[model samples]
Target: MKLFVNSLSFLLNVSVVALVVGGATGLAIIRDHQERLPSIEPLLDYRPSVRSLVEDSEGSPLLSLGKERRDLVSLDEIPEHLINAFIAAEDKNFWDHEGYDALAITRAAVRNFGAGGVKSGASTITQQLVKNVVLTTERSIERKIQEALLAFEIEKHLSKDEILERYLNEIYLGRGAYGVSRAAEIYFGKSLSDLTLSENAFLAGLPKAPTRYGLDIEQGKGRQSYVLSRMSLENMISEEEYAHALAAPLLISEGDNDTEQDQASHFVRSALTEVESIVEDAGDALAEGYVVRITQDSDLQGALEKSLREALIAYEYRQSAWKGPYKEDLPPVDSWTATPVLMDGDSYFVSINGEPLPLSKDSVKFANRGEFTLAPGMRVLVEKVGDKAKIRQVPDVQGAAVAMDPKTGRVLAMTGSFTQDGQFFNRAMDAHRQPGSLLKPFIYAQALEDGWSPTSPILDTGVAIQSNGQNEVWRPRDHNFSKSGFVTLRSGLEYSRNSVTLRLAEAIGEEKIGNLFEGMGIHKKAEPGLSIALGSQESTLLDLVSAYAALANDGVPKRPVMVESVSSKDGTVVYEPEDFIDEREPFFDEVTLAQIRSMMAGVTEYGTAWRAFEGAGYTVHGKTGTTNQARDTWFIGFTQNLVVGAFVGFDAPEPLGRGESGGSTAAPIVRAFFDQIDETYRISDYQLPDGAKIIEIDPDTGIPFDGGFKEIIRED
Candidate 1:
């Protein structure tokens, strides 16, 4: 009896010691928690990084640029099914969990211990929000405890809806996108509210493994199926709804449907350079919700891209000769393993599954020829086009087009190259190439300023001269290498006569002509030779187009503008581009400018660009230019309201082949672009100034005649 009593006393003492030690340890943990816990204010007011969106003049989104591509939406805007899908996939007991789920933690610990490594996570939705916003993702006992403590603090401060909203918006959803809203737009090209049941399920499965599933919808399907099953098991969705979601195929949106691949991609990319220059920090500016308003017309931009592709394709078809067949091994018919061959008359040839198929006329009619070509060994996308097989060529040859509002110098449409899929080179603004005969209008403008009327006769006969630093005698020839002796200045410009322009430039003096070009916005230093009259000086398409805008604007030169304004997140104006008329000065007298415009009008009426707008009732004044050896081709023109410039040539400056002049190559592209414009946007005619007089001039001589056609003569 004494031994038993002693044993009980010792057990009591041991229990007392155990309690004291345990209490001390627990107190230490509480102290550490109190010291390490972070303030929940920042987490509650979460501000996610977002991209800066570029909008057109009409307020339509053109493109977005930044590291994080996110579109923030309120919790109220999120669909119920989408929210439930996430809850079912991530944490089924999200509503009941305070911070961490004890049951889930125990299960995860057991499963991880069995697997011999950390794999599964027991983090609740609150804990996930904590980890994403305030805590790091490092896997450790300390980090997990800190996350749990922070989550509990967050839950105490924010409501359930607020926590869910923060978590949804802060989570990364892959493809450079963050948050559910961006994920919905990126993966399905729809808003969170617009997402179907199956799409919501697909998006719910992304947070866990975004890259692995978001890029490959097929791989994501399995995870989506698992999520749908969980929703059904939890009774969040009906069995019929679950079954429908499971049976519904994942309809991923096209890759090019995103804002980055939109019609204004090139324009957006070009505008980004200017955006960065104006903003304090581009990434931060975008993250803080800045908006860039640019001078782009979405409809006109789309039309420009389409017309450029079609025109290039037609050019390729014209140049291509049928080479029997593709004759290469290809994949299955529906598979993306087809190769495009040349188009012969009515047939478009392509090899599919090692068999050559001839596309019917109807099928090839509407194909994106710019994207696909008949270039030898070029792989293309073959699809059915209205009862015919269409072969689309991946474009290789580069081209540029720029259209501007002459009245305001606003860029209506601008494409640097045929393809902008991630390419950064903006040829329209940066590429410097010979203007070819596009410079003749400036020479003619200078001639009209020198008191020489368009009716004055100039020798179109060939003339040889010794260039300043050259040993050989330089002889200038017309584009057709044929001489038309003693043609008037009107005929000289109308025919784009090289010899007559050189003579006119010589009579006016080369230095004066160079000064005239600089006044019209050509900043390049003109060479001291007659070739300057033929556009030997290298200039950008932007500058050349802007120069023509001066002619179209009656005499005042307006600077070309792309970005119109920029605003901060709170609707505060950060930067607004103001039109400074101080820089715009009259380069020519009103009468001289009128005469120049009239002479340019004669070009489209009967000159090389006649074929461009032959049947189109709208009258346009323009000039077509072809460099020596046909290396570069250009057609720049303007109506009273708009000025457009187009260029087509190899980057390395090689011949575009025989007979491919600016009139034949570049003019057609401009024609196609203008044809797509709405009638309201097209200018009918150039309004004549008050002091201009109409006089009938003889075609053979500079004298006025009663029998000849009447021409406008400016008398200011």
Candidate 2:
């Protein structure tokens, strides 16, 4: 076959010229000047599109944002074996060829003639570089000739190393990476020095068809084998090295940045939104190659995400329904094997791959809970936890959460929605849902500032008020339907009694409460009605958290900000948010803030949310708000230094279950989230300011009474 190909090489060359000159002249039209070709100056002064790096508060990479993720490296920076591998795989005669290889072109032409079509490409590294940078990726004869001529021109201007460097730095290598250096991070999660022979070969084989071979394990290994054999045949590697590489296991990195960003999609997107506003021009932040410093604590963000997902899934499992299988299709139940890991009789752990994937505890306990036991092949959603993997599910019920530092108003972490792929609408900031009972604290705070004390008695029985229509009367009752007739103002908020709150609002009138709500930025306009007392107004989760931030920060509300600063790739300060954290003025006076916080503390103590945090070992002052029929449930709580708001509901209003309220649905989520947060912020008892009095009134008779001998004569 070689002798016959050599004999026909001349005929093929002649046929190539005849076909090119006669049949495909339109592809390569004659030009008087070389101006038709792009200049090599741009290649000499190369600046590939670099991805924006998003780092956490500690300067650790949380995610990357860009169109083409690249980490630029010079030819000298790349390892010698990697260069050898690419040369051996793509073009071993790269050093000898001027631009296009005549022998390779002749062979490719002969094969195309026999096959009756353009079957292959014989572009050397230089020609490919030209096609990638200067010319369109058209496969016609004109584009081909233009590409070859342009490659020859580039060869005259640039050295072999320069051409190879540009090719290596600019080629797309799958996973949104556009260079060998970035491909190393994406495929191996390490620098080139740490890449093994098998891993290096795998990357070397990806340029031909990155999407096809990079993702297909079988095809990737086959391609890697071919590249390895070429390297061996080209004397790039010894026989022993080739055999070892062939036998060595292909250790693919589990922690790709895209997937890592996906794990924190809500946070990454939220951070990028602020980053865009800060940078100049700010149209395309990814292309600007900015280094963004975000306020997200990865540890806190991870905890909130897991707890939120678990709480949502647990809510799903409690209902007497199944929200279909993962990916909307069940696994065949015959392919993969998963085993439960019993760790020291406490934490529950699970695994996917024994060698690569790390095991995560408490992520696979769904099977251990109900009758749906973990069979060997049962399909379940699994989340990649850094180096480990865990079983999980995407609950149909969507929700959002925000964790803020009440002291600095720095947004520690926030999630827009349950991160199912293809879901981009952020619920954390944009979701305009009714605050429900979460507004009780602010309501009582306004009332406290308006001459009503926490001990002020309010009739809890049903009261009728005028509605919008003529002679239309609106009667509001307690949420539990069972009224206490008369209860302390504190008890009204503690029990989340709708009637008591309405009575208090009626006494204080809508003007004062409306002004207070408006000041909290709950809404632009406040309505004149008693329903607003029961939180019948829409507000964002972030606004609600900020309102609670006042209670935690001595009545001062700190503005929630995501980005700390942004810098250019050259380390220049592009932009930094001046209002990153300001707003030192207090919304409520100290007395009102202290009194209202004490009343809210009663909520988790023995009121509606008691069962959720009875033994949580954390003192959380919060209110539970459940919308009509449990469509939306909210629990916005705060500690001495931290404030967190949790929301759980379907995208469109759907009933959570038969008996799930904010206390049952949302407060437990808050507890789960707080449970995972580090114990840096400690919960403390609310201190009543001067001139504040707590008078316990009898629920039956609305009369202040003290214990006969224990509490009658209390001393300060």
What's the TM-score of every candidate structure?
A: 0.62, 0.60
Clashes by residue pair, model 1: 371-393, 372-392, 372-393, 372-394, 373-393
Least well predicted 10-residue stretch by lDDT in candidate 2: 707-716
RMSD of 2: 18.7
Clashes of 2: 3
Candidate 2 residue-wise lDDT at 21: 51
Off by over 4 Å in 1: 1-48, 67-264, 321-358, 361-380, 383-387, 469-471, 479-484
Please provide, for model 1 over 1-716, each residue's C-alpha lDDT reduced to its tens digit, 9 standing for 90 to 100: 24422332233223221233343453455346546677776686776654556799899876664447667889999999989999999888888876666677657656655665445568788988776656544444445556666776676678889888887887765455678998888788887778999999998987766644654466689999999999999998999999999998788765633444233366765565465455432323333356888889989988887777666666665554333323456532332455655555645577665666676553344443334334444555564444445544444456889999887888889987766654446678878999889989888887887788888887767777666667888886665533446888888898898888888888888778877787777765666777777888899999889888888885766677888877866576667777646455577777777888888888888998898878978878899989988889999878877888899888889888887888888888888887889866567465666877888978667688997967777665
Which residue pairs in model 2 clash with each other? 27-142, 358-387, 358-388
Q: Compared with the true structure, what per-residue lDDT tens digits does model 2 show for residues 405-482?
A: 987778998887766343446788878888788887877887777777665667767778874344878876455544
User: After best superposition, candidate 2 residue 431: deviation in angstroms?
Assistant: 2.1
- Candidate 1 CA-lDDT value: 0.72
Model 2: residue 133 alpha-carbon error in angstroms:
16
Backbone clash numbers for all candidates listed: 5, 3
